[model samples]
Target: MDVAVEVEDLWFTYPGSTEPTLRGINLRIERGSFTIIAGPSGCGKTTLCRCFNGLIPHFYGGTLRGRVLVNGIDVASRSTHELAREVGMVFQEPEDQLICLSVEREIAFGPENLGLPTEEVKSRVEEALKALRIEHLRDKAPFELSGGEQQKVAIAAALALKPSVLVLDEPTSNLDPVSALELTKALIELNEEGLTVILVEHRLDLVARYADQVVLMDRGAVLVQGDPREALSSEEALRLGVAVPKPIRLFKQLLVHGVKLARPPLTSEELAEGLVEFLGRHRG
Candidate 1:
């Protein structure tokens, strides 16, 4: 497989803390795949993501062991600035990443800080704005935009660097349902264009069906990881409060009552199809 990010026996501990936050994590995320990293709170999901862009031991000052590679480069070997060219990170809170006054400036900030030529920076800014389809908001200030708009601006800023990978941590936590769905669709569109997306989120109902792979982490380690159907349906994941999508959960209960789907369904649409097929067969 063409791997975008690889973690081998990774371990990390925060400064002034005794217990490690991440423990013996081994994972491989394929190129151009939409992968979701999910689990209960404090399962080290965010910390593990930090390792993807050289933020763990580099910026957070922690004890890091094992190896983490992004786009075939060792994360510990490069500065965050260096990796920013290869991996763009969007945090849980869009406001935390937004500092510029205007939307265009927010998108341009990264390339400008990278010291790209004037025309190159401007070109990148325009490309990012167009990519996110936010050209109409170019003149507005970030503080004036909605939560979803700010998140889009943050993503656009990250894209301005022209990175091959995008890692987001619970990006929809603050948005309304409509905005969250819109953001999710935007990310899906980006992934369809071959950008490797690693989304750290708990809203399985919103994204589980769209992921190529689902990784369930718990207590600072990966408890289950594989195809979404298998990973999210794992008894271990469900027992650990991984928040399996409602459709999947409902079907599991149906199976216990002697109603089995040809396969597990990840979304409501799939669940409905399964039932329809089952009913037709019975009537026939």
Candidate 2:
């Protein structure tokens, strides 16, 4: 029930850019919750994520205003390296994150840089390998792995940091459909295991079912923010071009024609079950 991240009136402009990429953004994400931020391309989704882990003002060299806090610590007051300990970030492209040659080395990179003992670093690496189910690929070269495997490695590296919050910006962008689904399932599993997850994604139909909270942003401002059931199905979200999961879309379409569903469904399985029950009742 505690807040993992809080943003207040956050405004920022990149170095040499005349306009601000983000404006008046306010959001509160609960700890251990899986939250998704969905918006059109160039909606400042990535810019906002950079702010989450203190990369905006610290590393990106931007003119930042307002405040962004992660785990009660102000982002602007901290160094990127300090923030990396509290907030782990995975970029859209896993290739960008493959700093080391082998998967084992990549996962150990963070802890090693943190000055942990050799045994502690190895233990962290082993823990991340187990957590991400990528131990078999430990000695393999990251570049030689499949896109999904590489993405999993990137996530494992972040997990090795044991951060309080994990912010992923379009983590599945380069993945196949199956790989994307796997990535989302992995995120849900992590959240269930007590890691706070903040995802910036575009494929809502696949990811929506896993998100407890959905946020819609446009023109560098939050348009809707709440439970996925309410926020993802809102007219404002749709009008703003945020894609609603098909189950909810179908449910809404059926209701418009006088057919009432048991309730709004966030997944296809729920919709199917509800429809079967409704048909059975009518046939009786």
Q: Model 2, 1-284: lDDT tens per residue?
A: 69999999999999999999898999999888899998888989999999998889888897999999999999999888889988999998889779788999999999999999999999999999988888999999999999899989998998888998999989888999999989888888899999999999888888787787899998899998988888877888778877788898899899888778787788888999989988887785
- As for candidate 2, its clashing pairs are none
Q: List the global CA lDDT of all models.
A: 0.92, 0.90
Clashes of each: 0, 0
* Alpha-carbon deviation at 259 in model 2, angstroms: 1.7
Model 1 misplaced stretches (Cα beyond 4 Å): 279-284
Q: Lowest lDDT 10-mer window, candidate 2? A: 236-245
Full-model lDDT, candidate 1:
0.92
Candidate 2 ranges beyond 4 A from true positions: 276-284
Q: How well is each residue in 1-284 modelled by candidate 1, as lDDT tens digits?
A: 89999999999999999999999999999999999999889989999989999987789998999999998999999999999999999998988889989998888889999999999999999988888899999999999999999999999999999999999999999999999999999999999999999999888899999999999888899988899998888898778888788988988999999888877899888999999888887784
Model 1 steric clash pairs: none
TM-scores, one per candidate? 0.97, 0.95
